[model samples]
Target: MKKFPMTVGGEKALREELDDLKTVQRPTVIASIAEAREHGDLKENAEYHAAREQQGFIEGRIQELEGKLGSAQVIDVTQIPHTGKVIFGTTVDLINMDTEDTVCYQIVGDDEANIKGGKISISSPIARALIGKEEGDVAVVQTPGGGVEYEIDQVRHI
Candidate 1:
């Protein structure tokens, strides 16, 4: 089985979702299905069909979460010694060589990546280029337009 690397926060979020699905959603959907069953025949009952569909979705999500949680390798970046080199779960500050603009991004797992939140996926082109690079080193990221160079200004465990 492939191990899923994730931050502590990411693991916690998935666990929370799993808990909600099992404790709240599963029971609620069961109740809905039972109530819909009393209303009419199975073939023409819209409410019963809708409830069953919702139940399928909830069950599927629960299984997916469980599988992810089972294989998750949670990495708490704060516990690692800082070495000024970009690594998984490290926050990196970079200066664009061509535009002179700066950007800060936290290297995170695929499920936890959010560009608006300054988190980039570990498998992304830019993050892949930045990995193993130290402060003051320039990383060239290949993009569709062309290669873009970013100078690593800082690498933080926090």
Candidate 2:
């Protein structure tokens, strides 16, 4: 099985979701199903059907979370030795060569990637180009639009 990389915070969030699913959602759905079944008339039981669908969804999420946790390779960014390179879990400040716009992004696991949160997936084109690049280095990223250049201003491991 291929292991998925995850930051400590990402892993914690996933674990918390799993715990909530197992402890709360699973039991709540089970109880709902039981209550629905008590209404009788299995042929025309909308509540029972809805509860069953919800149960399926909850169980599927639980399994997915468990699998992710099992195959996760959690990395603690703070514990890793930093040499100013833009590796995973490290935030990098970049200046767009064309637009001259400065932006900061943290390369993180796929699950933790949120552009609005200043996080990008490690597999993203920009992050791939930024990897192994130190401060003051130029990274050329190949995007669908065209090739874009960015100058690395700073690398922070947080």
Looking at candidate 1, what is the lDDT of residue 82? 90
lDDT of 2 at 1: 90
Off by over 4 Å in 1: none
Give the per-residue lDDT of model 2 (tens digit) for 15-107.
999999999989999999999989999779999999999999999998889988999999898998889988889999999999999999999
- Model 2, residue 153: distance off in Å is 1.0
Candidate 1 per-residue lDDT, tens place, 27-98, comes to 999999999999879899999999999999999999888888888889999999999999999999999999
Number of clashes in every candidate structure? 0, 0
The C-alpha lDDT values of all candidates are 0.95, 0.93
Scored against the true structure, residue 73 in model 1 reaches a CA lDDT of 88
Considering summed lDDT, which 10 consecutive residues are worst modelled in model 1? 63-72
TM-score of 1: 0.96
Model 2 lDDT vs. the true structure?
A: 0.93
Which pairs clash in the backbone of model 2?
A: none
TM per candidate comes to 0.96, 0.96
